[model samples]
Target: MSTSRGAPGSVLAVDAGNSKTDVAVIGADGRVLGTGRGGGFQPPLVGVQVAVDTLADAVTTALEQAGADCVDHVSACLANADLPVEEEELAQAVQARGWGRSTEVRNDTFAILRAGVDEPRGVAVVCGAGINCVGMLPDGRTARFPAIGKISGDWGGGSGLAEEALWFAARAEDGRGAPTQLARTLPAHFGLASMYALIEALHLGRIPAVRQHEVAPLVFTVSAAGDPVARSLVHRLADEVVAMASVALGRLGLLTEEAPVLLGGGVLAARHPELDDRIAVLLAQRAPKAVVRVVAAPPVLGAALLGLDHVAAPAQAHRTLRAHYA
Candidate 1:
């Protein structure tokens, strides 16, 4: 695939996640002319064409609002585009839509990373439903993890934490593990009397499996209340976050230099004191020059900024776009 010619200096920026999508139209000078939101993009589940069709809905709305048919480039930071091959496949799919002259596809983690920094020179660790890490430099070099869950040697996402909590709670209830408050709290969260009942409800679909993510926050609550087991789990998550950040920093050759380590996603952005403090302390020990910050900006801004970068927009354009999001 090659770049298609369209309106010069215009961009169609898309940030497509597992649960939702955000699209924006940016003018040459970095003003956001229009924006739109749509349902999730899950190619692995719905197939490539179907997922792109879902994205097209939002793109159509944004283009209508902007009163334009197409733009010079499309910058899409998408979930499930974990590997370079997947990104290429997705890029081709997006380009086929004719929304832009050119398209670049990246893992959604890059949006979080780019959104948190002034320039593309940082690492980002995102821990929402799942955990992933990525790092990038202005020079176009990048470091990343496969981040495909347990089979990929990844752990400590919200769902993973909930499952870990349930495992320990179940064992504790059955005298197979150390006693912990999780045994009581885990079942209580679901209005059950025991881990046995909770287990049965989960197994029998009485409680939808999607609701299990709710347990992750309770684990933090239990830890805050000083349950040793819960605290251990929280601290372990901190370890994993720091470990990934340090490794990414090293891979980018930024470990010895002062670099931003952006924290985004539900778990990390929650500002859980225990997890935050532990991650800070551990990261400081491992990568003393690492500067950490939570990314509060919506990631569509990052996609737009990446588009501007691709087109070589002026510095004022970056500032203008950032101010709009701010």
Candidate 2:
């Protein structure tokens, strides 16, 4: 389990999410020679070929930036590899490209786990383009959710917040819901005077529908201003995060033991005091021995660390990777 004797190989670490893809080329010496980013790579929405092509652009750019042709391993944590079958398929496809001597394709959330903890054994919840969670124990037992979007009874993320914000704003404007600052703030975010105007623009295609996800931040801003409805949304998100973490802890019998609870992704990383405080309080209540942390490093760092784990690189190499990534 210890890789103190330095291995000899490079790591091509990829952190591919729904909105952006980051690729890093790291030497065995733990130097991050270069990093590059590209557009989202969602196979379900855009097909497998398009996703691979987009990934190719980012990987090519990173390798070019590093002045290298390939690496020893490709540690790819991708959003599109939602299901086990998908992960296998993508792993085969990536290996066929000969980008590295070996490859590991996993759910993107795993990067959050590897990035935030030194032991690589803990629970991680990611609330980026969507919310997903995974947990691992020292014994290699794991707990994970489908994270297949709403079909899996999932909620809480930028997308979830945006949809709820729009719903509340439209309802408040129509007199069906309690009045709140969201009606004014949500529209104001897009330079519109009212929620109705924003709705009309969205319906008429004047505003890109995808931009609706951007409204999530306004919910936090309004909540901070003491909007009851906005606060409720934030609380619900915190509740969901704790709920998942608690279940994962129970699954691994780590509930009564000291464990790390790592948080990553944009929503949690935003450092909203209200949401952050609630998560901390709830975790302490639900799993008293849990250690909580919000990862500031990009998930690509986690992917790189996992690659180093695969190659059995020395601990010094991990320190070097962290320092370079720092």
Candidate 3:
């Protein structure tokens, strides 16, 4: 529980996303001593041990910079630690590294939620390549969704939006659905003349499937230009965001009280006018006391705050940490 400088209550905070990982070492007084950034953590693809090994590289760099051999607590907010069992497994793997005296793992969405709020009490709905929601209270109670994709009753992430845009555009092009501008714009984005050509390119790997997420923003552009189908998709996404936020707020008993509904992830952070305005209207109708805000801070700050909270650090400690990030 002590650092090289003989400081107790030091924390190692980790925010591991699907694309990258960030690590920070904070003293008991909330001074950020050091930080490290490394590749993504994807246990589902690389296996747990291998994934934590990737994290170790960053952790080692951070600890070296901080002049600490270990920390009192390891607070890791990780992507793909979606379910409780997954969190437990990842926690065990992290603990086995002997990086800290204690370890806690949570879905990465909680990092965004915590990052956007002054305290632990708030709801966060993140719409990145995928969508997820989580709510928390300082008392340790939390509400969350499975967030494993369509099978988990979830929809409206960047990937989902891209897929939906393709579907409607394909249907429109083939005369199977109502005519829409998506039929033209979706294909044009890729320099193809027709949806059939775009479809062939996507199917034949001429255009990497990974590029599909790029279509999400194009959908917003079309919506802004008055495309009915594209506009509908944007509105649906807003609906999903509000639905997830309101439900999480209600579950945490924050629906009746004033609470922050923090929007995070690339899609929400972009603040598309249609999506933003629609979410505001719907959330106002559903959770009248909800105050919506898009989180601009890096989520690693949230992981660090959660660590300080775990150690019961004083309010000044939290302020100092926030100021460092600020």
Model 2 shows how many backbone clashes? 0
Candidate 2 lDDT over residue span 1-326, tens digit each: 11111124788999998889999988887888778899887899888767878889888887877777788899999996878899888888888877787888989998989898886788999898689899976455778998887888899899999999899989999999999899999888899999999999999999999898889888999999999999999999999999999999899888998999999888899889999999999999999999999988889999999898888888998999999868
The true-structure Cα RMSD of candidate 1 reads 2.6
Residue 120 in candidate 2 has what lDDT? 75
| Pairwise TM-score winner, candidates 2 and 3 | 3
lDDT of 3 by residue, 1-326 (tens): 22574256789999999899999998898989889999999999999999999998899999988988889999999999999999999999999999898999999999998988989999999999999999999899999999999899999889999999999999999999988899999889899999999999999999999999989999999999999999999999998999999999999999899999999999999989899999999999999999999999999999999999999999899999999988
**Each candidate: RMSD:** 2.6, 3.5, 1.5
lDDT of every predicted structure (CA atoms) = 0.93, 0.88, 0.93
In the range 172-203, model 1's lDDT, one tens digit per residue, is: 99999999999999999999999999999999
Point out where model 3 deviates above 4 Å: 5-7
TM accuracy, model 3: 0.97
Q: Which residue pairs collide in model 3, if any?
A: none
